[model samples]
Target: MQDFYIFAKNFHINKAIIRRDGYIYQSLIAFFMTGTGNSYTVARWCAQVAETTGIGSQLVQIKAGEKRGAVPSRSLAVFTYPTHGFTAPWLIMKYIWCLPNGRNLHAIVLPTRAGIRIKGAFFPGLEGTAGYLIAFLLWLRGYHVQGVMGVDMPSNWTALHWGLSKQNAAVIIEMAQSKVKGMLQTVLAGNKHYDGMVQLLVGIALAKVSLMYLIMAQFILAKLFFASDKCNGCSLCQSICPKKALKMVGRQGRPYWTFSCDSCMACMNYCPQKAIEVSPFIITLFYYIATVPVFAYAMSYAAGGDALQWGISLGLGFGIQYGYTLAAIALAYGLLHVALGSRIIRAIAAKLSHTHYFRRYQASNVSLKDIHLHK
Candidate 1:
């Protein structure tokens, strides 16, 4: 999390790579952001390759609101983060936005995605805009882009589906490590490599989905979290939220999600009591409320004549309706939080929530302290 780490032995660079331009790559620095630790693990593996190659290396976790000073001259910088929607997450985007100008500093982009294994078949995650978009931004910031690639790890979206078994996850992670090693080796050799061209092309076709994810879907997802009946008010999720998006509320100090949340999945996975849950009941309600608008009925009396004149659509007004949907869900969640105060109500809600019966996931190697220390 801090800006200082030397993975190389004794701070020594046993072999400094000399480029054709006469610049020597003596060290590496990887800035990574992770939720449930997949991206962080990929960054660590890249650093491990640096360590094995006798190159000095450092790791800096790309935390929300943490200041990045400047890029060191002669050091190769690597930017890695988990893919959200079809691209980079909000935390990754904000972190990159705040970095100082790269000034021709060499850099690479590695975006991790939700790799999965089902019935002994492995399916790779799609990077879509996750790789090149970040690279394009870095290039605009004066970075000499060395490579852009996608790495697949186990999916940690336990909110939507079941978590992978250990054997399945192990297979995916092992393949990812191999790719990471290869990508770093290419850069160290003074060559350029790029990957995910197919995913990028496919991602371009789905650009609208990515836009919706960034602008609206993520915000809506934030409202779906709640404390289950199993909660003990440990306050651990609140303490480790990267955006500080979780606040301890009420007499019991239970975690509450705020608008600042980007749906990073940190608070849900790392809760010691597994008290956090995503409400299926609320999701169903939200879908119906959002899709089947009440605005039409409320304004229906004048709508038959005024709709043709004033241009009222089925959504009433697309932008206004969307905004109202977000607001309505927020209000409903606020009431749900208040209702959860009663033990009987909380238990009933928990029984209806699918997340209550689902297994929670984090990277096997990742611990809550490891995440907290990263911040």
Candidate 2:
């Protein structure tokens, strides 16, 4: 099983979505993430929920080159994959594109990401937005849509470190079922609010901006400071990369990241070289600082902004919002990073040739990208 997790919260539940074609349309598209297997686990639960609710559900296992036009209509399309860097896998995007008139169709996106540094929820719901865009395109072709939600899974790398518990799994299944049920009801109620362009635009804008920032983070900030000298260029990073962004290209035979990187940190995390250093200390500092505030904003939204009881600090709220504004200043830089980070990292390496410990290990022709799995 791959990239599987559970959502155990009690939520509003709907039973089914009967398409105009007279078929209860429900579909699950999953890309099991490596190391954790949360994708597969979550997918199973989704299928189970669809069964329990008596909804017509279909499961599609999407690989690198799977076709999408073959999928039947009036169905719930569920996507389960791991986050590469901070975004969903390219394969997922490809699959979405393969869907005929994808934008106009409603889809449920469930991504299994690096649950170590953060929860899967730490992500800004880019996958859901992907579904929204797909649904929007499909809608233009006469397909209607529902909304998106998420479920977090535990990982050895994350705060949990411990493996998922059976109780946890049970809760996640029940909650997921409820949410799916609720979403189905919303679909049947003739509610058309979640069926338009605003959702699409917002989703696209956010994903675009995030991708831009991620690129910048990797190239400008990450590569400028870190060198893959230790990299023997064994291409282990290339092998594990769900995006196939990293390829062996250097004169020394080390894997170099191309523009296709999603920044899920698979290379960095799994780098045998340990040569990939995300540094300047300032960048990490900046990232964490920025992350905290951004997380706060997400929390605020989750709390319903003004509707919830939680209140923002009087003096700090304005500052935080302003701080977020400052962070937005990095968006241009982020875009630039994505545009040139890989090239710049390599170019600088060409200019300087100082060998260090991190370099020799990477150059050793051994698998240094070993993961320390937690029980």
Candidate 3:
């Protein structure tokens, strides 16, 4: 199942994007750390592999919830991230929609998720839909296109928590070599069915339900918990609030979420306030744990009776995957925070904001660690 297209593209590509969930801090560490299974790190490694094979390339970050400009020509735009509820982060949807065309633009979508094969199908679906839709839009707008590609990264946090003793850092390097090689082969072979397979996966009712949950989680629950007390009155949140839903109040302790909250969670995750409270990391952990059983129940609901055999099998398979995925992320968080300094988070927030969305708020005096953890 090796793809030759990926190989051909890898050897001659020029530009690419290295995406991450919720923040760039983790991504930067992943890039530097080598094995953490982070999307950015994995994608960068992939790019380098592609380079050695003859592709000249550049990698950039696509933050959790913002949009970026067109991928430069002859360049491969690589979108990477940890899957949230089986899909890319909510904000990444906009990025997919905005993908530029007309110049034989190629796409490489890398989704990092918990280590389950069932869940592995999720990101390909998201990437396919976004890519197909963009291609269609571009076609209408008069841009000739080549196509899109996708790869999966191990769920580092979940894997570590589940007792998967193998750190994702090493896997990062391995996946970069093997996965990129496979992708290159696929691309060169002109195998377009991957997109169709993505369509089939997404067409299912269960998949739709899963996607809806992700949307609500990002656009709803994520906002409330993200606004806790750790925010440092720094207006950085207000500055990058893509929806302009944040504003500084009387120069107090931190920027406050306004009525325009879209639940993007950028403020909560990136706020230097140390003022925001609540752990999105913890919340997501619980979410994966709880939903494992629910996916079981949902199948029962759809079948009019418990598909006990299917449920049992999937439960075991997906369960193991989730366990491993969660563990890896947790370990990554602990190791990077303690060893590398959570400053990666601040750096990511700053780098993420460096784009058009956060350009106005660039001059802030806030330090990445200036915000304290909530008591």
Candidate 4:
């Protein structure tokens, strides 16, 4: 993937319109949807490079309920987001969908995937639909796509595993700094550089998985979160949530994740108490509950026959099962949240969550002030 970081030597800056787009783009606008600040760092790098080239730049964090604003003349909008479940996050999708016709701007897209340096080697994550999905949406909105590239930032999904060591994370982030600047320079020079075609194809092949994740997996993951015994009830997680999906509920004021949570890791990584956790026991329970075939059994009993062998209305059964899964998870999460207020239950729940043992991550340089996660 070393070569993925560089462009062809023959590539030269087009002083004129960046391509057939036929516009002198004077400003660089970067819009980033970030959780742990990986995408935020990428946006800053692009903006810095553009600034040095005498192009004024603006950085905007994509948040829910953000109103549409006027588009500037001869401007290029760069979108940087982390890849979630091999595709774009719902926040970004809705942002683009709500965008007014984009005849006024050109666009470039960069999706930062989970990347890390281990034993002096760099491994990149699969981006899937994270890149083209957004580009396609931009194109449909009438923005000329200048380019699309996947950036390798330090792996920030700490809930599933440990975070990269500072030494290893710095290596990956340092490489990304140079790579993102190159991508921005190439696009600004009126040359098109579409990277990650192979990853895109592979992601397309897993479209069903991505779709299921977007609709079901993500929603379920949202409910798996809980504030542990270590929580001092600071409510920092509630204030930092970009979607405002986290609520401090009951007498304890413990943070409770709602369905609106995008599982963006903002709450998990930024908790000073290190108390936010994904309950493995609950997740496992959810997995078994979802596969219990309760819907099939109900239908079988209602019809006085074996519905399983009959392949009875698989589509309808799936829909019913999906609802059941979500409903069950939500109800279970509520009970668990309340239960955790107890010392014994909280201790047991804390032990069951792998995240309690895993190291947390956020970009080294970013602060709550930087991304407005605090505001």
Quality of model 2 by C-alpha lDDT: 0.45
What is the C-alpha lDDT profile of model 3 across 1-375, one tens digit per residue?
211112122333343323222111011111111112244455555555556544465454444333344443444444555445444444455545454433544444444434422322322223324334434454553344333434444333221222122343234335545765576445433342233355425634345655665534343333223233334455666665545665554434334443345443345445454344434454565455435453454345335435776666676665555555444544543443332223445344333321212211110222332221111
Q: Write the per-residue lDDT of candidate 1 for residues 99-184, one digit (tens) a residue.
A: 77788989999999989999889898888999999988888778999999899999988888877888899989989999899988
Once fitted onto the true fold, the runs of candidate 4 whose alpha carbons sit more than 4 angstroms away are: 1-22, 298-312
Assess every candidate by TM-score. Answer: 0.90, 0.46, 0.45, 0.90
Error at 204, model 1, angstroms: 0.8
Cα lDDT tens digits, model 4, 1-375, are: 111111122223333344444558667778898888999999999878877776667787888876555456577888999999999999999888777678747789999999977799888888998999999999998888989999989888887888888899999988899998988888877788899999999999999999999999999888888888898889989888888898898787888889999888988999998988877788888888777786785455346445663455555566777888888888888877777779678777888888888889989999988975544
Provide the overall lDDT of each model, using Cα atoms, as 2-decimal numbers: 0.81, 0.45, 0.41, 0.82
Model 4, global lDDT: 0.82
Residue 71, model 4, lDDT: 50
The 10-residue segment of model 2 with minimum total lDDT is 357-366
- Scored by lDDT, the top model is 4
lDDT-based ranking? 4, 1, 2, 3
Cα RMSD to the true fold for all candidates: 4.0, 14.6, 15.9, 7.0
What C-alpha lDDT does candidate 1 achieve relative to the native structure?
0.81
Clashes of each: 0, 49, 56, 1
lDDT of 2 by residue, 4-88 (tens): 2222222233555565545454443332333334455566556665666555444455544333443344355556665543454
Model 3 TM-score on a 0 to 1 scale: 0.45
